[model samples]
Target: MDFLHSSWLIGLAIFVVVFVLAQSMFFLVKAIQRAKVLKFQTSDIKRVMVSTMIFSIAPSVAILLGLLALSKVLGVIIPWIRLSVLGAVTYELPATINVVEGVFGQSIGQRITDPVLFVTVVWVMTLGVLPPMIIIPLFLKRIQGRVKNIRKKDQRWGEIFMNAMFLGMISAFLGYVIAPRTDAVTGESYVSLLAIFTLLTSAGLMAIIGVIITKFNKEWLKNYAVSFSMLGAMALAILYAMLGVR
Candidate 1:
């Protein structure tokens, strides 16, 4: 863990955080200035700022949970930096688990104390996300143009195409959630019921929240729905674990 939490790493993490904060502040200031130039009401701007701040809290709670999960093995600094930056929990946890189990053949249940293993995990996680950065800049406009053309030609198929893409991405995670694995010690295969149940629970909660938002006009829940679903599913996971579900 010493390597994971070395002074140099801590300093680098702190530097990254401070740089992100400064970048955010710069953009915020610029936005406010532009808003003023555009003759937006001061009160309206303030209200928007307050509402955004409130809405951010729920998502931050989910990120905090991810940080805790990763911190247990990777230590606090790396996870903190990752989550605080562009990294999403959806991508970070799975990438870490994949590298630990698939690449290194090690259990995430144990801390990554080896500096080489730690570096490898960090590099894999970092590199895995790079394709998106490159792809978006190079091809996103072309993709959007094609989507627009499809929508112009046939709106229904356009929507179906978009939904198909989304579901295809989701299926990748679903595969991970429901996949079976052999216990390293026992050599017996078993699926992770806890993950499957948690996924179902979260999906159920999201569906309920969607119903409330649509049928009952609880629009504000839209901001908090994902957070609530994630937290509820996590709570159910703990209960499942206590009941000996693996």
Candidate 2:
């Protein structure tokens, strides 16, 4: 059996994907039913669902790009299963590379030919991300309960806390993008100005959208603004690359 494209691997991938769809459908149906019980209009519920679907498309496409990148080395099955489950490309790629380079002294660009190395890579990938799954299940409810209590105590502070968390995440990503890197083409040390520009472009567009939505009461833009901003920022990144911003 081919380790990369075996029939059993494909079958397992299918099963996992199907399970994800099934679980989402279950929650969707429950949400709609609960909305109805709470006297939400059908149109409102449908609008929310449609808006969510629209908002998800851009991020889903980004994930697909990540899947494609990883597919070059790991093939389709492992990345497909990982991305379909809880693993993001940001985490999975680094975890795989760390194990491969640290253990085998090889780059991910090189195809992993040894079965033992492949198994080791898989184990590292699995174990590296396992803590989150265990911790979430064991403590997520308690954490959420505390958050809810705080929110109930002071709604303004709750909002501030959420905003702070979001800003923290954004700052982390910004720091990552602006970190120094060696130019692939020139082999010179430089910061990723293109990524920083792209990040700022996306944020600017989002802010503009927010202002437009608030000032003009353009409620419809709320659903699609994020997708538009992301795509716009990506387009700007491409143009910046063409203009030698990298």
Candidate 3:
């Protein structure tokens, strides 16, 4: 809570926590892909993971700096845009935080199915502490993976950069458009009850869909899962909003 008042602390904390967590997920995914492609040498897997984790940190550093600079520029040049992004990001915190906490506990899918806990957590998680948690980590992992592995896949850095920008832009666009619509349906007025309900239902469905995909393809949906989350959020919001304005 106190961190909300300190932009510098907020930026730093988001970088450190989300970068580490996202890098770990990247490492885990890479390990799985490696296992699928080659023999499971524990040593090779561990060595690659350790190296990837180290490499992943740099992009996150760049991203955090960019976010901070964005904040500063938007704050000074287009003050309202800063407030809007902050507010939109703030509105999304609860679901993000709960997801992260649950993921850490390996309960992400389980909790997403619980309407009551999910809603309650989303309520608490907002207030501006949690949105950046998930958002930062999601973007960080994607960017770092793209950066480090561009050469692995014979890809170019410019392409990777464009893709990373696309993801961030997509996330923000989805959040802005989808979230408020869900908020309207929520009827909570102050916080939007429908936001959480729609959010969790979508997340739950996504996890199920991901599992279905993974059974055959293994690690296919691991990275793409994040973008689907945005789509899921938007779909639920539209469905709920179709009911009527709150």
TM-score of 1: 0.60
Candidate rank order under TM-score: 2, 1, 3
Candidate 2 per-residue C-alpha lDDT over 41-120 given as tens digits, one digit per residue, 9 for 90 to 100: 99888877887787788789989999999888788888999999888999989988887887788888966778888878
Off by over 4 Å in 2: 38-40
lDDT of 1 by residue, 27-133 (tens): 99999999999999887778677767765775788789999999988999999988877799888899899888888899998789888888888888898888888
**Would you estimate the TM-scores of all the predictions?**
0.60, 0.86, 0.28
For TM-score, candidate 2 versus 3, the one ahead is 2
As for candidate 1, its clashing pairs are: none
Q: What would the per-residue lDDT of candidate 3 be over residues 1-246, giving only the tens digit for each residue?
A: 222234774565556556666887898787688696787766656655565555455444544554454333222212222222343433343344455465434333232334444445434434445567688877988877766786566658657767887999968855753454323464543545566666667678778878878787856455445555656666677777787632
lDDT of 3 at 81: 25
Indicate whether candidate 1 or candidate 3 has the larger lDDT: 1
Worst 10 residues of 1 by lDDT: 50-59
Superposed Cα deviation of residue 167, candidate 1 (Å): 14
